[model samples]
Structures are given as C-alpha cells and as structure tokens.
Target chain A: NAGVTQTPKFRILKIGQSMTLQCTQDMNHNYMYWYRQDPGMGLKLIYYSVGAGITDKGEVPNGYNVSRSTTEDFPLRLELAAPSQTSVYFCASSSLAVYFTDTQYFGPGTRLTVL
Target chain B: GESVGLHLPTLSVQEGDNSIINCAYSNSASDYFIWYKQESGKGPQFIIDIRSNMDKRQGQRVTVLLNKTVKHLSLQIAATQPGDSAVYFCAEGPIDHGSSNTGKLIFGQGTTLQVKP
Candidate 1:
C-alpha cells in the first residue's frame, strides 16, 4: 500500500509567495494531519482533519491553512511564506479507532525553503 | 504550551551496544505516548507506543518504558547498529474531552543517535 503520499518532495519560495503541499492516503484513514519538523525540533502539528470536510487548527497553525475536500486528500497551504516556515513538512493519517493510541502512518515529507 | 523535550540532544554508541533515549513531558494528562525515528531526509516513522495503563511495551529490537508519575518516557534500542543512526522523538497525546476528543499529539525535540562500527 502507498500508505500516505505527499507531492513536491522539495520546494523553494520567496518571502510572500504562496503554495499548497498536497497530501493523499490510499489507506482510507479517518484522521489526517500536517506537521512541520524544524532542525532539532520535532514534528509540530500544523493542522488536521477528522474526516472529509472537517478540519481543525493545531499547535502551529499560524501562516498556514488546510483543506480536506476528500478522504484521500488533505493539503496544507502556506500564505506569505516566511523564513520561519522553512522546514520539512510531513503528512500522516490514522484510523482514529482508539483515541490517541492509534498508529499513525507518515508520508515521505516535503522540504520547504523560504528566503 | 505543553511540550516534550529530550534529556539529551545527541548520543553515540558502538555497534552491538544498547542505547537509551529519554524524554520529559510537561503535561501529566497525556495518557498516550509514541516513539518515532526519522532518517536524514525522511519523515518520522512510528516505532512503538505505550499507554498510561501499561508501563512498558516491546517491539522488534526496541522497547518503550513510561513513568506516568514522573512524566518521563524512554526508548531503548537494543544491539544498536549503523542502520539505527537517526533522530528519535517521543510524542505525547493529550487526553482531553469535548471538541478535542481527537487527542492530538505533541512531539519533543529529538535526540540524534549515532552508531559507530
């Protein structure tokens, strides 16, 4: 299975440019998440969706937005990208079966560089 | 904000040795925990998990120990090898109710492990 897939393995953006990081999962998971990993810092949640059309903001939601138009896709949008937004972004999905104990499968990740 | 931070930033161990990475969490309400490994250019992959009810869980060559009373968690990798070199992260899930029933996870700053031959 492809588990989870993210497009544009690498990207670069100017200070004010905007772009969307596409994410998809063939696992048919109910929970999808977007997270960013900075240097020594671990993954920080950017946004998440419980199901199609249901999205919620996470710990580091500033300068970012997300949409879950379909079960197989949850794309993260960066607006007016700042150097602070330069980080490796990952997409994940889970069954949401037993609350927080479910295992999350991750995508390869997209490295974004903003100057 | 509630967060998880590692006790060490880096660790080096010889092959065939055991490695232990520790983490301290700020929130006691976190009942679920997970350990993830990330290679240089890859996303964090789930290794194992332990819940508050259980103090320990073992998988393949890794074991996770949780001390809820102290808000401490550790991941032990046995017979460490060069293939095990990567950044390890521990994550805690908040056990909140209402609109946050989803129980999102909070990740710690990772510990980089380097294994030598």
Candidate 2:
C-alpha cells in the first residue's frame, strides 16, 4: 500500500495566491491530519479529521481549511497565502486515533514558498 | 498556544554512540506522548510512544520515556547510526475534547540530531 501520498511536491505561491495541498492514505485510517513545519520549528497542526465528513481546527488552523469528503482523502486549502504560510507541509494518517497511539504514518511532504 | 518543546536545539553524537533527546511539555492533562524522527526531505516517522499511564516504551532501537509529574519526555537511541541523524520531535495529546482515541496533537519545536562518523 502507498501508506500516504501527497501531491505538488514543491510549489511557490505569490502573496495572496491560493492553492490546495492534496493528501490521501491507503491504510483506510479514520484519522487524518495536516501539519506544517517551519525552519527550526516543530510541526504545527493545521487541521484534522477524525473521519469522513468530520473536520476540526488545530493549533495553527489560520489561513487554512480542510475537507474530508472521503476516507482516503483530506485536502488542505490555503487562502490568500502569505509569507508566514511558507513551510514544508506534511499529511499524515494513523490506523488509530491521535491519542490511541502516536504511530501516525506520513506522506513525503509538500514544500511551499510564498513570495 | 500549547507549548510542547525540546530542551536542546541540536545534538551531535558519534555514529556508534547513544543519543538522548529531551522534551518538556506544559499541559498536564496530556495523556499521550509520541516521538517522531524526520529525515531530510521526508515526513516525520514514528519512533516510539509512551502513554501517561506508562513511564517508558521501547522500540527496535529507540526508547521513549515519559515523566508526567514534571511534564518531561525523552527519546533514547542505542548504537546510533548515520541513518539516525535527523530532527526528532515530541508530541503531546490532550485527554479531553475530540475523542479519547482521536484528538489534536501538540508538537514540540524539535531537536536536530547529527550522527557523525
């Protein structure tokens, strides 16, 4: 199985531009997450979904939106992208819940640069 | 914002030596803790994890220690190899809200481990 797959491996966005970072998992996991890692900083949670049709905000949900239309896909949308939004974006999924175990598997990552 | 942070910004160790990375979390209600290793140009990989009910857990070559009283967490790697060089992160999960099994995770800044030969 492809575990988790993320699209747009790298992208550069102009200020105020928008884009969507795609994520998909083949593990049939119920929990999906979107996180961004800045230079020398820890990964910050952007949005998460416990299951399809259910989504919620995380610590750094600003400038981002997520929709879980299906179990295999959870996409992150960035609106009016700013320089602050530039970072390495990673999508992850876990067989169990976030609290059940920290054994979430991750996608390669999408590197975004906002100019 | 919830602050789960690493005590050291970076660490350097010999290829065959052991390595220890420490983390400090502020939320006492956090019931779950995890350690992830992120290699260059790759996503974070689960190293090991420890629950609030347990003090330590061991994986293949990695171990996680959780001290709930002081909100401290640590990851130890024995016989570190070059592949072990990466950024290590410690994450915490609050017990309430969302669900007992599924909730948001608060990640620490991260400690970069450099394994030198």
Candidate 3:
C-alpha cells in the first residue's frame, strides 16, 4: 500500500536556507506526524495533524511548520534552517479507530544535514 | 516532563540466545506502550505493544511485559537472529487528556541490539 512515503531520501541545506519535506500516506489514516531523530537519541515530535485542515505543534516544533490541506499529505517546512535542525526526519501515520493504542506506521525517512 | 529511558545503550547476544531489553518510564499515567526496531538507514518499525490493562502480550518471537507499579516495560526476543540487530526503542502513550486520541508517543533513548551468529 506504500503505507507511507517521503521524498528526498537525503538532503543538505545551507544555513538560512528553507526547504519542504513531503510525506504521503495511502492508508487513509486520519492522523499524521513528523518526528526528528538525532544521533544516539530517540525521536522528537515536530508536528502533527489529526485530519485535513487541522495541525498543531509538537515537542520540537520551533524550527518547523506543517500544514494538512488534504488527508493524504502532510509536509514539514523548515525555515531559516540551522545546524541544530540537522537530523533524520520521519513521517508516520495511524488510524483513529484503535485510538487507545494506535499503531503508527513510519516511512523510510529523510536525512537532512544543515550546514 | 515525562520520559522513557532504556537501561542499556547496547546489548550483544548469541544468535540463538534470548534477549531482554528493559525500559523505564517516569509517567505513571502512561497506559499504552510500544516497542520498535529500527535498522540502519531505515525508519523505526513496530515490533510489539502492550496496554496498561494487560501485564504481558506475546507476538511471533517477541513478548512485551509491562509493570505499571514500577513503571517498567521489557521486550523479550526469543532465539534472536541476525535480522534482529538494530536499535530498539520503547514508546509510551499516556491517556489522552483531551477528547481525541492524539496518539502522542514518548520514545526512549533506544538500545542497540547486536546478534552474533
């Protein structure tokens, strides 16, 4: 089902540069999320959307922004990129039926290096 | 803030041996837990999950045990295989304070498991 797919497997951005990481899911999931994983660290939530037209900040959303204009797409935008934003970005989606313990399916991930 | 942490940063075991990965969570309110395995250069994959209502749950060759009293969770992999070599992360999902099930997951630092044949 290509469950979830992300673009630009890897990227390197210069300081102050801006870029968008694209994510798409065909599972018809209502929930989508963006997370960043640092070396030797767990993933930190960047942003998430409950459904189309709904978006909210997560644990580490300072350098990023997101929008959910459609149910199948959730893109993360990094503005004025900094070195601190260098990390592996992952996109995940899950259904709301099993809301109590929804199992999140993740994409391959986008490796970003801000220099 | 609430956090989930692993007991060990790395674990090495024989291919045929069983492996147990431990995790400790600070939030007593957390009711749902999950274990994920991430291979090199790949995103994390779901391995198993357990709810606060059940102390133990078993999957194919893996089992998850949750101890709410001590706020501890463990994942046991039987006959660990080379394919099992990866970073294991434990995530906790606290009960949704709001109306909807946002499914906010708090992940642990992760444990790198090495299976030697």
Top-scoring candidate (DockQ) = 3
Q: Please give, for residues B1-117, the per-residue lDDT of candidate 1 as tens digits.
A: 687999999999999999999999989888889999999888889899998889999999999999878889999999999999999999888655554566578889899999999
- Each predicted complex: what DockQ? 0.58, 0.60, 0.63
Off by over 4 Å in 2: A97-102, B96-101
Cα lDDT tens digits, model 2, B11-63, are 99999998999999998888889898899999998878788999989989888
Ranking by TM-score: 3, 1, 2
Q: Each candidate's TM vs. the true structure?
A: 0.95, 0.93, 0.97
Write candidate 3's Cα lDDT for B1-117 as tens digits. Answer: 899999999999999999999999999988889999999999999999998999999999999999988999999999999999999999999767555768889999999999998
> Considering only N, C-alpha and C atoms within 3 Å, which residue pairs clash in candidate 2?
none
Q: Which regions in candidate 1 have their CA more than 4 angstroms from the true location?
A: A98-100, B95-99
Better by TM-score, candidate 3 or 2: 3
TM-score value, chain A, candidate 1: 0.96
- How many collisions per candidate? 0, 0, 0
True contacts kept of each: 0.52, 0.67, 0.56
